[model samples]
Target: MEGGLRRMSHHPRKRVEKAVGALNLAHLQGAFYLLFLGCGMAFILMVWESFMDVF
Candidate 1:
């Protein structure tokens, strides 16, 4: 257990932790809202087959 604990310095996990800590709540909320809007637009376009070649 002691040896495993010492070897747990994974680089990607540390970077992700840093990034998560640095985010602003207001910006995150706005990003999510824009993502939701984009997905809704995509769904509508897909259903209507607006751009058959691109889709």
Candidate 2:
């Protein structure tokens, strides 16, 4: 019974670690997506401005 309890405690700790890692990955992905979107928008705006100048 004591060994079982110890084993159960370790599983929860592992689960907590996995959850934290998943959250960090999600945060990194969000930041990357935002950066990508910002860059794309900036590129589009530059192109539009150049076109306007030509016209």
Candidate 3:
């Protein structure tokens, strides 16, 4: 994960290398999507916990 992030150098245009373009595009999006879902669930859990504590 760290290696992949280092490869990007935070540049949009250079994010994908031609040889592994398909692999990178597919998996990177999946990784980001799963990360998004994970964060969403964590936030929901926190909100629910606080709401339950109120009662």
Best-fitting candidate, scored by lDDT: 2
Which parts of model 1 are misplaced by more than 4 Å?
1-23, 50-55
Q: In model 2, which range of ten residues has the least summed lDDT? A: 5-14
Ranking by lDDT: 2, 3, 1
Candidate 3 residue lDDT tens string, 1-55 = 9999877875665555554797888899999999999999999999999999999
Instruction: Locate the minimum summed-lDDT window of 10 residues in model 1.
Output: 3-12
Q: What is the lDDT of residue 32 in candidate 2?
A: 100
TM-scores for all candidates: the values are: 0.47, 0.89, 0.63
What overall lDDT goes with each candidate model?
Answer: 0.82, 0.99, 0.87
- How many clashes in each structure? 0, 0, 0
Per-residue lDDT of 1-55 in model 1, one digit per residue for the tens?
8777666767668888877866666678989999999999999988788567666
List pairs with backbone clashes in candidate 1: none
Query: lDDT score, residue 9, model 2?
Result: 88
